[model samples]
Target: MVILSGLMFIGISIGLIAVKYKEAYIGLIENRTDNLQTPSVLME
Candidate 1:
C-alpha cells in the first residue's frame, strides 16, 4: 500500500510540472511574435 501511494504522488507531481512547462513555452512564443510585429522607430 505504501508503495502504491508513493507512485501516485510521483505521478501527480510529474503531471503538474508538465503543465507548467507547456504554459511557459507558449508564453515565450507569444512574446517573440509581439516583438516581431512592433516596428522600431530608431530604424526609420
Candidate 2:
C-alpha cells in the first residue's frame, strides 16, 4: 500500500511538470509571434 501511494505521488508530480512545460512553450511561441508582427526599426 505504501508503494502504491508513492507511485501515485510521483505520477502526479510528473503530470504537473508536463502541464507547466506546455504552458511555457505556448507562451514562448506567442511572444515570438507578437515580435514578428511588430518589428522595430530605427528612424534616421
Candidate 3:
C-alpha cells in the first residue's frame, strides 16, 4: 500500500512537470515569433 501511494505521488509530479515543460516550450516558440507581442498570462 505504501509503495503504491509513493508511485502515485511520483506519477502526479511527473505529469505536472510535463505540463509545465510543454507550456514553457510553447512560450519559447511564441517569443520567437514576430506576430505575437503579448505575453502569456498563464505562465505568469
Candidate 4:
C-alpha cells in the first residue's frame, strides 16, 4: 500500500512538471516572436 501511494505521488509530480514546462516553452516562443516583430516595426 505504501508503494502504491508513493507511485501515485510521483505520477502527480511528473504531470505537474510537464504542464509547467509546456507553458514555459510556449511563453518563450511567443516572446521570441514578439521581439522579432518589434525590431521590424521600429525600423519602419
Query: Highest TM-score among the candidates is held by which one?
Result: 2
Candidate 2 Cα misplacement greater than 4 A, ranges: 41-44
Q: Which stretches of candidate 3 lie over 4 Å from their true place?
A: 35-44
> What lDDT tens digits, residue by residue, belong to model 3 across residues 1-44?
99999999999999999999999999989777834566656657
How close to the true structure is residue 41 of candidate 2, measured as C-alpha lDDT? 65
Per-residue alpha-carbon lDDT of candidate 1 for residues 1-44, written as tens digits (9 for 90 to 100): 99999999999999999999999999999988977898766767
RMSD list, candidates in order = 1.9, 2.3, 7.9, 2.5
Q: Could you give me the TM-score of model 3 versus the true structure?
A: 0.71
lDDT of 2 at 9: 100
Q: Can you write out model 4's per-residue Cα lDDT over 1-44, one digit (the tens) per residue?
A: 99999999999999999999999999999999998877776576
Clashes of 2: 0
Cα lDDT, all candidates? 0.94, 0.92, 0.88, 0.94
Distance (Å) between predicted and true CA of 4, model 4? 1.0
Between the candidate structures 1 and 4, which one is better when assessed by lDDT? 4
Q: What is the lDDT of residue 21 in candidate 3?
A: 100
Q: What is the overall TM-score of model 1 with all chains considered together?
A: 0.78
| Model 4 clash tally, residue pairs | 0
- Global CA lDDT computed for model 4: 0.94
TM-score, prediction 4: 0.77
Candidate scoring better on TM-score of 3 and 4 = 4
Q: Order candidates by lDDT, high to low.
A: 4, 1, 2, 3
Give Cα distance to truth, residue 32, candidate 2, Å: 0.6
True-structure Cα RMSD, model 4: 2.5
